[model samples]
Target chain A: MALVEIKNVRKNYGTLEVLKGVSLDVEKGEIVTIIGRSGSGKSTLLRCINALETINSGEILLEGQSVSAKMDGLRQMRQKVGIVFQAFNLFPHMTIEKNVTLAPILTGKTDKQGARKLALSVLERVGLADKLKAYPEQLSGGQQQRVAIARCLAMSPHLMLFDEVTSALDPELVGEVLKVMEEMAAQGMTMVLVTHEMNFARNVATKLVFMHQGRVWEQGDPKTLFANPQTPELKSFIGHHAG
Target chain B: MRQFSFSDLLFLATALEWTFLMAAIALAFGVPVGLALALARTSGSAVLRTVATALIELIQGIPLLGLLMFFYFGIPVLVGKDVPTVVAVGAAYTIYTAVFLGDIWRGGIQAVRQAQWEAGACLGLSWLQQFVHIIAPQAFRIALPATVGFLVQLIKNTSLASVVGLVELARAGQMISAGTFQPLLVYTLVAAIYFTICFPLTTWSRTLEARLNGAR
Candidate 1:
């Protein structure tokens, strides 16, 4: 069964129509990379899946349960689906350890000592165990992004959504965040990300979706889609990136 | 006119207690309600937002002096009941501080990055929990300087209670000056005492502001 199913979702911001009849499904452990230009509704679609942007019409299901504010067990549903933003949104006032441990204790009733142990383990996964005592401001941008990833991982989520996670980073810092993502995918974790990194999408994604003008223009195996452009839109999109 | 005695000075000094008490009553009644007002103003519900906004504006439009008079004199006369001046004074200060503090703290809440809310929501936290753990703490930090500065203002504003016949520090000054016929000396002494109480608070507020900036 698909881990997430978004059906005919429609979203509008005031008079502006952002997502028009967007739909997709993610099978377990699949790395689905969505690549598109700014304002193409790629980020909006990802946000909808996590219920960040409410759909004006249509529905979304996670693990066969509906996603909505009124949905029963919404908290439990959220515990299984984690998201990371383009900007590292770590709590500046909290230590790295506390940032990682907070959700577990809040959502799962994990005690402080247990949460601390869990924090250390997850921080180690993102190569940040040594920075446990440091505040978000004390870390470099790359390191901060890694801590964000660790914070998500600490929840043991089944699916992770990343919204242009590397776009805000300095050119040099982008690699570290991407490497952490690569490792995450390699561990057989399910990930759906909206990214501008064409090379990473082509090489790392099992399935690549090309979004344009608030719709999925093309989608297929990453290698085949890159080798042969299926439509003039996808052709130019890829061609523009290549040239 | 009576001579200026040390006992009269002691009386004025003791009035500081009433000053502090009035200020405390204002804060105790004000801060929590102000926080509620701020939350309602920022909440997504249109009705709550409008109601809170209207209250803050209505109260803010009226000066604290007017509120003191309305409570102390207007209500008692209209209701045909004898209300203690202290009760009237306390109620006035509470409403005055709540309105002002609510407006100040709302600015602080808005100063918090929207990203923080989104991050908390993504973690599946309930709205109140998100506020308690994530949003409120950050907003309080951002709001600290204004909040403390407002408290100092509150201390000074408590002197306005004298209008309603509560002899706090400022009213004590008036009585002492009238008795001793040393207007300059008594007023100067009162001003010095106020400075002693309020200056440290102003400095503390500045220090917090500097530290907040340094943290960023």
Candidate 2:
């Protein structure tokens, strides 16, 4: 069974539909990069997978269990799925160490001493081990994004979702975040990302998904799909990025 | 006409205690109740939100004097028994403080970015946990200056308790002025006392706001 299965998911914000009958499957250890226009619902689809935004109809399953289940079931599913947002939403009042350790300690996944150790290890993984005492605002955009990733890593999630995580960074700083994500992919983390980094999508992504007008217009092996455009939307999208 | 004496000033100083006591009573009861109202106003349930909104609006719409009069005069008639001045005045101020503080804190909590809640939720933290650990501290910082500002207003408004026959600072000032017929001198001294109490609070509020801004 696939690690994550999304079946004919439909979502609407009032009368305007965002995701229309979108379906996909992500196997374990696969890096699936979703790329599309701004309103193509790429980010919305990623949000739906984690149940952050509820679908109007259809099902999202993780490891054969429903992701839309309420209360404990939903929370239990979320514990295994880590999502880093575009905004790098670190808790401003907390220090870097507290931000990384809070969830693990609160959920009883680790005690205080163990959580400290876990925080150290995860911060090191993101190349931010020395920033333990710094607050979110004290760091630059890229540094803050790295700390956010470290926070998610502390949970030891099985599947990680990246939603335009580098979109808000300065061009100079974008490379560092992408490098961290690349390392995670190299470690065989199952990741589904919605991003605009065409080169990263072309090289690192095992599977490339092209979405247009709230539908997955085309998807396949990244190299094959990029080399041969199956649809005009994909062709134009690639052309736009190539410029 | 007699002059304003030192003993009269001592009486005013003693009466300041009543003013403090009334303000304390209001806050003691108001802080917790106001927090509940703020949570209810921001809660997911429409019913809770509406109820909280209605209660806050009701208390806020009426003048503080009207509330004091209603509690002092209306309650005795409603219950067919005389209500003590302190009980009526204290009750009035408590409800008054609760609603005002509730609205202030509700704005603070709402001002926090929605992304903060989502961040916590994605980490598998429960809603209460999200609020306690993620949202509350941020909201408290946003609300602190306004909260302190409201406290200053509450202290000044305590002078209205004199209408219910309580000899607080303002009432004591009135008594001294009536006896000495030195209204200007007596009122000036009263105003100075009020300035003394409220000035420090306003200063503290500004300092707190600056410190929080600097930290960010």
Candidate 3:
């Protein structure tokens, strides 16, 4: 069974249909990169998989169990999946260590000492060991995003979702956040990312998904799609993003 | 006919004790009521939200003096049961504090970006957990100045309890005036006393605001 599966999921925001009919599968250790125009529903789909947005219809399954909107199922689903947002969204009042350790300690997955140890190691992984005591306001945008990533990594999530993580960073800072993501992918994290960084997508993703008008326009190995012209929408989308 | 005596000033101190005691009771009980009202006003259920909103609005619309009269003079007539003037007056102030403080804290909670709530939800924290852990602390920081400002108002408003014949500061001054026949001197001293109590709180509120902003 695939690690994650979406079968004809549909979502609408009032009169506007954000996802018409979306379906995809993520196998274990697959780095899937979703790319599209701003309104093409990439971020929406990622949110739906994480149960942040309830689907209007159809099914999303993780490890052969359908993702139920019921509290217990959703909690179990979330424990396996971690999501990072465009805004760093770190709790402003908390030190980086507290922000990193809160959910784990509150969820009773670990005690204060164990959560702190996990927080230290994950902060170290993000190259932010020196900033454990620093508040979010004291950090640079890139550093904050990395801490956001480390906060998720501390959960030991089986799957990671990045929603336009670097789009909010300054041009100079974007590289640092992407580098942490690249390292995660390199270490074989099953990552499903909604991103606009074309070169990173082309070079890193094992499978590439192009969304257009709330549908998957095309998808294939990154080498095949980047080198060959398939659909006009994708060709033009790639044209606009070409290096 | 007479001069204000040091003994008379000690009597004023006794009045100040009543003032502090009544205001303390109002504030102590007001905080939890305010918290509940604020939560209800912000809740997802339409009924809870509407009921809380209506209660807060209705209470805020009534004058504190009017409320004091009704709770003190009106209730016994309506209920055909006698009630203590001090208890009724203090209770009115407590309800008044809750309504005003609840409205202020609602704004503070809202000052936090909606994105923070989404971030908390996405993190798998329960809704209550999110408020306790992420939302409430941030809201309290935003709320401290307004809370202290309201507290100063509550302290001053306690002076109104004198209408129901509770000899708080102002009433104490009035007693001294009848004896001393020095109305101007007595009222000025009363105003000065009120200022002493309120001014420090206003300054403390400012300090807290500055410190919290710096931390942010």
C-alpha local distance difference test of each model: 0.89, 0.94, 0.90
Backbone-clash count (model 3): 0
True contacts kept of 2: 0.69
Query: Count of backbone clashes for each model?
Result: 0, 0, 0
lDDT of 3 by residue, A114-206 (tens): 987899899999999999889999999999999999988877899999999999989999998988999999999999999999988899999
Tens-digit lDDT string for candidate 2 (B62-167): 9999999999999999999998888889999999999999999999999999999999999999999999999998999999988999999999999999987899
Better of 2 and 3 by lDDT: 2
How many angstroms is residue B19 displaced in model 1 relative to the true structure, after the best TM-score fit?
A: 1.2
Q: Estimate the TM-score for candidate 1.
A: 0.97
The most accurate candidate by lDDT is 2
Query: Residues B1-216, candidate 3, lDDT per residue (tens digit)?
Result: 789889888988899998998899898888889998998888889999899899999999999999999899998998899998767887898899999999999998989888888777766778898999999999999889889989999999888999989999989999899999999988898899999999999998898888888876
Which ranges in model 3 have alpha carbons more than 4 Å from their true place? none
DockQ of each: 0.65, 0.70, 0.63
Q: What shift in Å separates residue B179 of candidate 1 from its native position after superposition? A: 1.2
lDDT of 2 by residue, A146-221 (tens): 9999999999999999999999999999999999999999999999999999999999999999999999899999
Error of 3 at B14 (Å): 1.1
Interface RMSD of 3: 1.3
